[model samples]
Target chain A: MASGGSGWRTLPPGGIIVEPGSSLRYKTGTWRVMRPIINQDKCVRCRMCWVYCPDAAIIETDEEYVDSKGRRWNRTYKVNYDYCKGCGICAEECPVNAIEMVPEVK
Target chain B: MMGSQPERFKSKFRGILDIPREERFVSGHRLCAGCPVGTVMRMLTKVAGKDSIIVNGTGCLEVSSTPYPYTSWMNPWIHVAFENTGAVASGVEAALKVLKAKGVLGKDVKVVAVAGDGGTFDIGLQSLSGMLERGHKVMYVLYDNEAYMNTGIQRSGATPWGAWTTTTPVGKKWKGEWRWKKDIMGIVLAHRVPYAATASPSHPMDMIRKFEKALYYTREGPTFVHVLIPCTTGWRFDPALSIKVARLAVETGIWVLYEVEKGKFRVTHKVRKRKPVREYLKLQGRFRHLTDDDIEYIQKIVDEEVDRINKMAGEEVIGPVEA
Candidate 1:
């Protein structure tokens, strides 16, 4: 149960989950010692990082991108730090080497 | 024709970049950092969408995704016992059918039952068989992490030959699991199921397409999709290498990706020149202890299976095995 909530007494009959996606309240951001940062200039918007992320932490942003070759990408990827455990699968799987795993300063 | 209405697009995956962005299997609860089961569930729910009820069997997917007071599932979900997931999913599918006929329920509700290899290949085989034989409209997905991971990597029937687990420890006299991995797809196919496919999270586009077909198409008996979920902690690999290892399994001949529909087998991801199984085996600590002879034995078994599957397809879907 989350903070300031009644314990077992207020639970649904037989403890059926009434609220969907209740796990959002429990943040897993602190679990990582390293964090992945995407290089905007280098990202080609291939979405390799987004598609390969096991945690679903890679978020597609409506940001504009233009590579050195004059190719344009309307959307790019960013990491959702709240749920990212820094597995670095995105970095490892990126075809362009756009993602880099940096030490979590905190 | 100018005034005509345009054709509506279904929820089909157009390409790798195109996918449903709905967060059905939301982040949280707790799964291992690089567990492909997470990716599997995410992609599955995305394909199945919101008008679905998920029946999860007891295993790591259940233990990690649905701890007390929270759940990673946004869709209607029920936690079934290890041995009765098929029964529950069948019941749910039946109930939905009756309710819809009686006008008690509205809209189409899809039923998807998910379980790890332990629950499906071993403990819950009977109920699963019953579900298939009865022809329920439930979609069954086997997330094969290759062992009972959450309870500490005990060997399951799905554990590969010569692979280490707590129960199948490497020793002087005893090797890893001696028995070959259970042929679940064959068993599923024997039920005369309409659509069944083997997939891996490494190939997300292909995986999602199979999930889509299993969830939406295939008009008859229960659909089964067996997916290999490479584990991080259990496999003892760098968490980031999860997808890479899964891809390697496909590139090598150890795990073949194919779909069998209406008794017809078709290879989905065909490797042109198959790599040696050692390239895949050497990465995971589970297969670290296999001797050269043992590795050769495994390779021989893979080559034989590939040839057999190739013969079944009547073409070289997978390339000839490499030495």
Candidate 2:
């Protein structure tokens, strides 16, 4: 199926993935036009967004954050733009309306 | 992850974030955006833990997760043909048994077999039947997205009645799929599986708990978990409303969350007053052609199913909606 250079013979033996979970190498961040932005100050860290995320785009970091309402969240959830498909489930499922889906600009 | 029984939830609602934080089913795969199975996969691999071997079938999860050189599976996995997921999984379980007996393997490595509705309810049914009948120690999970979603959303045995698909297109003469969705839970129960349950993507906690129960019962025999994952592409809904659609399935009494364990039937998520089926059908493009009478017919079936489960459970597990 190769156009010019190396053909199918160049692929690994048996097509076994030497590096497990190697799909991380192919970034899917470009698939989204609407990127979900998590407002740390408004987030309650209930992990509602994190749990519903299909892409595992919602990264749970060790970084702690205290919201504007004095709620201390042990971990912060950030959108890993690299693989986010911008499905808007995070924004829709967020109980506190902390996640806002804004259009991604080039 | 193995040996000990899964700690059951208490009176308090378990925190969704409190579970194991490891990302076993990592990102960068090719599953559709807002795909319900991705959420299920995250919870499933998280609950199953890393000390398990995942036996995936030729379905969407396999096609998307492992595209040639790249794979999203952090745990050991084997993707086999469409019709022999159970046979392959049984072989893997047998291999594990021999390894343990021979002192080559120490830790209790759980074998999890995952297949789509087509695999479980149709083509692979015989293989699955043999596995369950033989009492293999594998937690068989059927992700019922309701059709052959991997190959352009054709109607399968699991496709519910009155819903449109590529094979069962709605037209002047033909309605949607006339055949009722196959009762897989009933089939698994018939095989006398140690633990069997039906789960929905809307309830993650319930789904995770069911997965845990299935894992725990692997020591006894093969455990079957059937999860209703609303397909974003096939079901023809806004990808964002995936979870909502799943919830509507439960809320409308179309999908029941129950488990059959040691001959005892229990309803997990019970609805007090059920919504009209139209509320769920209206959201999806596939069911857009369903008329009022068509919806009424589906509603009758849903109501009867709710009552049937309630009768089977010997309690008013699902409360009826007073008109």
Candidate 3:
């Protein structure tokens, strides 16, 4: 949260951004396994959503969920599509059974 | 201004060899082909140069490089068990200090300890904590390859989330290594040592500079260098792509290049535009089970952590810092 040069360094706008064009040039390696799906309505406030994330992929908000933002409600949990591994733990760990596993499309 | 052109060129385009060549890890020992640690060890010793002593924890590097009579280390190096190198290095420093006090040993020799993630994060943490608290005049380098690669690929505390190690298999019931890597750097940085930097074999020259900073920054205080060394044997990657894989780590922001000196943080590699964590994870055999949504989830975390670090550096807040 600390801004200004004295405290911490910020990534310049272009800093550390991966170019989309470069993605396919190298081998995509292995990831063709499992996918994760989430149901927002059944989700509770339990932070279990944030704890088990290995890739640190879960996003939770403290604000109340509002429909006006067009984004999922605040305090509502959502997966950051950019980094989720779809391991299903988030769905599985949801105490309310709000998440489900779908077959990963090839 | 006229003289500035040649001077600027000399400084700007400096090659790596200008770094130094005092080898601590010698050649002709056993290490896996294309082991990332080998490259780190070579570059590290080059920076530490000629006058140094190393305390090696028992791991692939220690096991492979120092098999009995044959030693790959040219400098004065000792292999204590997996959990005691920090303590051992502390003793080395204390002994040198006592000897110096008694006018027995010269003050030229530097001391450093090399450890794996298993050694640093899980087993040797107590010793490391003690050394940092005591502030021994030594350097400790943790070659992080995620899991415990030396021990047939078991999961360590440093293994990333969603990674499939032998212990943390991905199955119908299980996803992968369940927990996140413990932030050892944050813990070490809290000690407020004279220097702490994360380097990668991908940036050999930058790595050399970090090592030099550690070796010479103080003859009487502790310093820690965490290097991201990719392991092919455990991660199941082509051995030849070790350097490339290491590069991907930085490029993708899964692993960052930065330093904290006296609590001032500076991220060296300007990622300019960040790479997705999936890009880094997808290259290795370990994360093969990850789905697109999974990749997105991981990307979110990587971005959050990066933002957290950058925020500490006072950079713009990007994503998921609350997590």
Candidate 4:
């Protein structure tokens, strides 16, 4: 077993796995400093943030959210902080100014 | 109501960032922080979309992303030797063509070949030229960082004159590299490919437009894109200044942004009032040892090149070339 007990000995010599998406095990969330907060009311469901996120941290959701302004939204976007590197490219590219980067509490 | 909008309008009207997230290159790769290559790769992959195959040459991008145990590419990627990216891409394109003809591949898949300047301008030139001559449907991208950074900042054929590298160190009698940078765009264009362009990571919008144009031209023949990727470590500049340095390269006319489609030249980002070359040269440590005469020499050459490109773009020269 390797350090994380994934049974490395069971694998081939180079730990080669003839598969894809195995990099998902490496969590990169610790790279974040400022987190993106999406304002659903202002969002036009444009998916701009989702597109520009270099880390692919932005996920589209069918679930709706009521903003502080009491506006309801049928579809929204969520930032998967697990992989977001706080690049702020999403906030910079959001056409409607719906995404804001706030200081990470932790 | 928004959903009711025409799909064509939605697709066309959306900004570069408004496109759907189809990331083929994921994070957690080991590219340096604030590295322009990462951004360039991300944006290029986004433009390439999911239905694309990437052929990478042995360079920083390759060595960093794919270690033995892990790989960052979500799309089908093939890693080739430093000098054979273009040859491999041709084979992949040929295979895809056969698959499509035999009804094995039901969808259209784009082929992209990526390499650094060392691979494209020097070692891989033969393969690249062959691929272009053969008219493979591959979009070849050369991320020109000047020197071979991955191999300890050695001087390469693409290293500009008066730039310092390990192999071309500044000595008492000798000053850095004594030769001008190779005109790779000219060499690539000589193949008579349908489309080719020079791009920089600093201008994201321009890069996106150029990539889209290159992809469009892939249907006709092969296309080539040369990107000036600023090397923070090798160039001895702060990592954060990578984009700024790249922008300065364009503003000073050192890196002219232009595209040639079907043998016609057009300057994509025309600088109405170009800055002096020294404004760009002084920022990097590679040019720290340059003398006044050297600076003047560089300025003169840059001005001449800018004039030539502007003339091709059919723009009137506003003022005399200044040193």
Candidate 5:
């Protein structure tokens, strides 16, 4: 609301509330809270964000976070939107940057 | 002492807010009584929490944390030498990748690298640049007390123009450092890392929220957070005035908090009205030697920097729509 630019079109209330992947828009970049989006294809399941997120935002089972081979991953990670503060930690700490912050529709 | 009364405690608190019961940094470690880095670290850990991999450079935080098999860190932490924490965090990310692949790590683990002004603006600049260039998913926090406080308060790149340091002292013939505070945040932004920000202990919530955003940039690759951690020892300010001095830094526009993403710039916190930089400088003993003319010059620099950032933030830049 604080002059966050005219081009920022508000999304319909019920539009899918996804994380604002790496592309966050706010006056301070600090003010921008992002949601996490896990790309299964690229995810290595490091779970760094799970351990690092100030708010416990990541969710994923160790079993589910496996590659093509039937091998368990080093860590399983996913974003829990309910508790996730939209802190980009999960996205920032992802070994592969697999987790991204996608914009959430208000 | 910050007594038990809540309102009185909060109002009297300096630099930033502290959420009791949340001991991110934990207790029982030693830092200098008036160390600026310690205060800033408290704020960062409070916001970053236990679910973070805190990579610290061999500075005050690292020294205090790793006192021969003891650590104050409540979070999963590591300490590499002075010039490579940024690089080491990159490797930590790589390891987490393998561990995550093996189903042994959590998605919530955030990676953060904390360094002093010397490490960030001078010695570690190259490694930080490399991390940014490669787009590593880490939040590199520069706790700037201006000079190299960890190493006897020598001058570093972050030392302000005409400020005194053991290395850059004022004399009858020469002023202090005699150069500008390197625009480290500005340099970080030029790399086009997904997120780059400047914060101060003055606004605890703001600083916390910034780290929140930094944590969320998982896919964006590389984020830099520069926090203005005022020094009581190095800057020669009263320990009690630390927070007040930090507030003055921003209020006077001597230290601006703004961010740039995809080349667009904007002011994160604006002081509707400007205050004289003199008021801010007058509080610090470091700048006590500054003549009115020197203060005027510094004031002009602050004003110009503010104006430039405001202009950039005003520009319109389109971003991806919410999925």
Candidate 6:
């Protein structure tokens, strides 16, 4: 494990960082102007939003829920607002018109 | 249960959650909204998998992802200077090979070097050429944003002609970028590497197939993939129109999708009814200053290039060769 060092003399070969996933502290969701609202009623649990999201903001949760139509769903999807940049790619890629990009109120 | 062949050919990625969640490049990085570079990075990382080490050059991808203490990479990653990504990857590959030969490392690992066009086409050409000639078992991917977007949109070697950049501004004396984009794929083919291809983020499956092919060629020698990534800020387009702009680039024959293996040329994605170049150029603000004559000039060039590629692929010439 290497710490912050001054020059190239103390750096590892090829500047390889031994630690991975060090970006957890940086919150990138503040850059979003639009947020995606997933309509569970229209969502077929198809995971289309999960795949097309460039930011990896869509998370698949094991906890199931019932939609407004009283339809039972197995797995649910949630947008990780802490990192989603709201590119609207998820909304555009949704085949069933489930995800809608609405202006961020806050 | 038997199904129709068309049903079998459906997208494998429809069940998106079924795709592996173990990401090599995670979120929270600072790439711009609707930046195709991020999408290309994600797709490449997904295809490369966990048994790989990524070597990134100093550019948008490097500066945005690894800001000092914070890094978005989940796999073993390295950040080298602009000109030496290929060199660094070569060193890493050598080290891994030595460790494996000594029985210290059990599993096989792949080395992938990623760089923007400014790093690859302009600054990093020497090291990239050397690495290719040396036949190192590394995959070099150049995400061609066509400009130095990280340092505020300057004209790069990969920038197409008549496109506005900070350096090549549209003025009375001169139109935006009077020169044509350099033929990087031709240069890579000149190296006579095992695999080389042109890809775009618009076609993910084609890009993924090329990535997998590059991975396969890692056992043979070096593999190079040039990807066209549309930049929303640099290209001066709506953020939502990124994918559409990229798709139009291919449809208009401006960026032909093709691959070269062992000196044989093949057109991967054929455009049946090629759209005119104006249709693609009209979408971006960068080409707003172009006159009808300028547009015609561009169309002529594109058509000639398409004819050349079709001839190489042994496909019937679809576009007019003579302007």
Which stretches of model 5 miss by more than 4 angstroms? A1-106, B1-20, B315-323
Residue B168 lDDT (model 4): 92
Candidate 3 per-residue C-alpha lDDT over B53-132 given as tens digits, one digit per residue, 9 for 90 to 100: 88899888888765543555666677779999889999998898899899998657789899999999999999999998
Clashes of each: 0, 0, 46, 0, 63, 0
C-alpha displacement of B42 in model 3, angstroms?
0.7
Candidate 2 wrong stretches, greater than 4 Å: A1-12, B1-13
lDDT of model 4 at residue B279? 84
1 or 3, which is superior by DockQ?
A: 1
* Candidate 2: clashing pairs of residues: none
- DockQ score for model 2, please? 0.74
lDDT winner, 4 or 6: 6
Q: lDDT for model 6, please.
A: 0.84
What TM-score goes with each of the models? 0.94, 0.94, 0.70, 0.80, 0.67, 0.88
lDDT at residue B234 of model 6 (Cα atoms): 94
What docking class should model 1 receive?
Answer: medium
Q: After aligning candidate 1 to the native by TM-score, how far in Å is the CA of B203 from where it should be?
A: 0.8
Shift in Å, residue A18, candidate 4: 4.0
Model 4 bad stretches (over 4 Å): A1-17, A27-106, B1-14, B317-323
Which pairs clash inside model 1? Answer: none
lDDT tens digits by residue: candidate 3, A1-106: 2235742254333232222112222221133145556666666555554533332345655667645335564466666555454444456456787777676776
Cα distance off (Å), candidate 4, residue B112: 0.7
- Between 2 and 6, whose lDDT is larger? 2
Better of 3 and 6 by lDDT: 6
lDDT of 6 at B151: 96
Q: What TM-score would you give candidate 1 relative to the actual structure?
A: 0.94
Tell me model 2's lDDT, rounded to 2 decimals: 0.88
